[model samples]
Target: MQQYDVYIERQKRKRQRLIRRLVLFSLITLIVLGSMAGYHLQQRAVYAEKVEEYEQLEDTLADLEHEELLLEEEIELLQNEDYILDIARTNYFFSKEGELIFKIPDESPSY
Candidate 1:
């Protein structure tokens, strides 16, 4: 009877230990999962910010590319002899040999 009682007591203690271990393991797993979830959320926010910045940079690059093309066209026009002559005549009021230039006054009343 004594030996049987001792065996029963040992089995109960073993069951208690196993339950405690399982509870501890579950708690640790929950903590680890929670930490990982937080980290993932933080990374997502950073990624979203980076994506927005990348989009802005891409838009700026596109605008700069368009401006560059316009400048290139202007440069080509400036390099042409006929375009230069036209620009000089209009801006500087230059005339060819024996050519006449008339200064027409504006009809609007001056303030």
Candidate 2:
């Protein structure tokens, strides 16, 4: 009878140990899964911000392309002889040869 009671006590202890080990394993798995979910959520937020930034860059590129077209048109106009003459007359104060020459004196220092 004494041996049987000792055997029963040992079996009960084994069962309790197994239950504790399973509970600990379950707790660890839950923690790992929760942390993974949080990490994925953070990555999604960062990815969304990058997408917005990319869209803004695309818009800026489109605006620059429009400005480039306008500049190209202006360049074509400047290639005309009359447009070149107009710029030289107003900006450089140019006149035809054999015309009257007037010299205006300036008090400011010339560099």
Candidate 3:
């Protein structure tokens, strides 16, 4: 009978040790998973911010391209002799020889 009692006591100790090991492993796994989740969220936020910045830069580039096209058009217009003559005559009061130069005040208020 005493031998049987000793055998039962050893089996109980072994079962308790097994349970403790399982619990410890579960806790470690939980901690690792939690940290991974946090890191993933942080990286996602940074990616979103970068995407927003990239979109803004793209919009600015489009605006600059449009402005460049307008400037090119203006440069082409300025190369025309008719446009240059018009600007010189209107702004600088230039005219052909024997042409009367009239200095009349504008009816509308000048800003």
**TM-score per model over all chains:** 0.78, 0.69, 0.79
State candidate 1's TM-score.
0.78
Evaluated at residue 97, the lDDT of candidate 3 is: 80
Best by the TM-score measure? 3
Worst 10 residues of 3 by lDDT: 96-105
Cα lDDT tens digits for candidate 3, 33-97: 99999999999999999999999999999999999999999999999999999999999999978
lDDT of 3 at 78: 99
Q: Judged by TM-score relative to the true structure, which candidate is superior, 1 or 2? A: 1
lDDT of candidate model 1 versus the reference: 0.98
lDDT of 1 by residue, 62-83 (tens): 9999999999999999899999
Who is ahead in lDDT, 2 or 3? Answer: 3
Deviation in Å, model 3, residue 17 alpha carbon: 1.9
Per-residue C-alpha lDDT of model 2 across residues 9-106, encoded as one tens digit per residue: 99999999999999999999999999999999999999999999999999999999999999999999988999998888777888877766476899
TM-score winner, 2 or 3: 3
Give stretches of model 3 more than 4 Å off. 108-111
